[model samples]
Target: MTDTTPADELRTAAQTLLDLADDTAEDMATNDYWRSAVVEPKHWFHNGIDNAVGGPAGKLAGLMSPRFARMLAIYFRDEAGRGQDFDTRAVTLARVMNGGQP
Candidate 1:
C-alpha cells in the first residue's frame, strides 16, 4: 500500500479536472456550435465554474484541500485570461500546482 498525503490527493484531483477541461477545450475548439455558443459569450465558462463551484472561489475551496485551493486562488487572482480558454487556464493551474512556473 502506498501512503499519500491529503495534498497529494488534492493535486491528483486537480490534475484530473484540468486534463478534462483541456480535453473539453480541444473538442470545443473544433466545434462551431461551442465556439458560437460558449466562446462567444465570454461569461459562459465563468458562470458555469462559479455555479458548479458554488461561488467564485468555491470550487477550489470545496475540494477540501487547502494547498490546492491556495494555488487555484492565486492563479485566478493573478493570471490573465480567466474567462478565456479553459484548457489554457487548467494547464496553467496544473503547472503551478506541480511547482512549475506558469
Candidate 2:
C-alpha cells in the first residue's frame, strides 16, 4: 500500500501545488493578482470565521505561497489554539453522538 502518512499526504499535496506554481511562473505567488485570488479565501478560524472578518480572502496559504504563509501567520496568531479547538469540537461531537454527555 501507499507509504504516505496522513500528515505526509497533506504535505505532498501542498508541495505539489507549490511546485506547479513554481513551474507556471517565476514568481506566481509573489504576484499581487495571484495572492489576492488564491491566498485570501481559505483562511478559516475555529468556527469557520475569517480572520479578516469579511469576504473570502482567497486560498493563498493553501496554494503554498510564502507571502500567503506570512499573511496566514498574522491572521492566525495561535496555531496550537486552532488545533485544540478542532480537537475539542471533534471529541465533543463524538461524545454527544455516543450518548456520553458530560
Candidate 3:
C-alpha cells in the first residue's frame, strides 16, 4: 500500500473543490479579503492550486482549477458571515503556511 498523509489528503480535497468551483461558477477576483483567505491551512490546498495556476501575486490564470475556485467561494461565504477582517484572515493563512502565528 501507499502512504497518504493528512497534507496530501488536504491537497487532493482542495484540488477537487477548486475544480468543482471552476466547473460551476465564475472566477474570483483578487481583493483584500481574498488575499487574506488564501493563506489558511484549511485553504492551503487552494493556495497550492492557485499557485499551480499562478496565484494572485503572480499572474491572473483565471481559476485554472475550478475546484479550487469553488473552495474559495465557500471561504468567502464564511468570511462574509463572520465579517472577518482582512488582516486577521491574512494572519490565519500566514499561520497555516508558515507553521505558526504571523
In order, what is each prediction's RMSD in angstroms? 12.3, 12.0, 16.6
List candidate 3 segments past 4 Å from native. Answer: 26-102
Report clash pairs, candidate 1: none
Order of models, best lDDT first: 1, 3, 2
- Local distance difference test scores for all models: 0.49, 0.37, 0.46
Segments of candidate 1 deviating more than 4 angstroms: 37-39, 44-102
Specify the poorest-scoring 10-residue window by lDDT in model 1: 77-86
Clashes of each: 0, 10, 11
Model 1 residue 13 distance off true place after TM-score fit, in angstroms? 1.2
lDDT of 2 at 44: 21
lDDT score at residue 25, model 1, on the 0-100 scale: 57
Assess the local accuracy of residue 100 in candidate 1 as a C-alpha lDDT between 0 and 100.
62
Clashes of 2: 10
Ranking by TM-score: 1, 3, 2
Superposed on all Cα atoms, model 1 deviates from the true structure by an RMSD in Å of: 12.3
lDDT tens readout by residue for model 3, 1-102: 997433333344445555566543333343333344436534543565456566474344433445555555455444434433433553354235335444
Alpha-carbon runs more than 4 Å astray in model 2: 27-102
Q: Whose TM-score is higher: candidate 2's or candidate 3's? A: 3
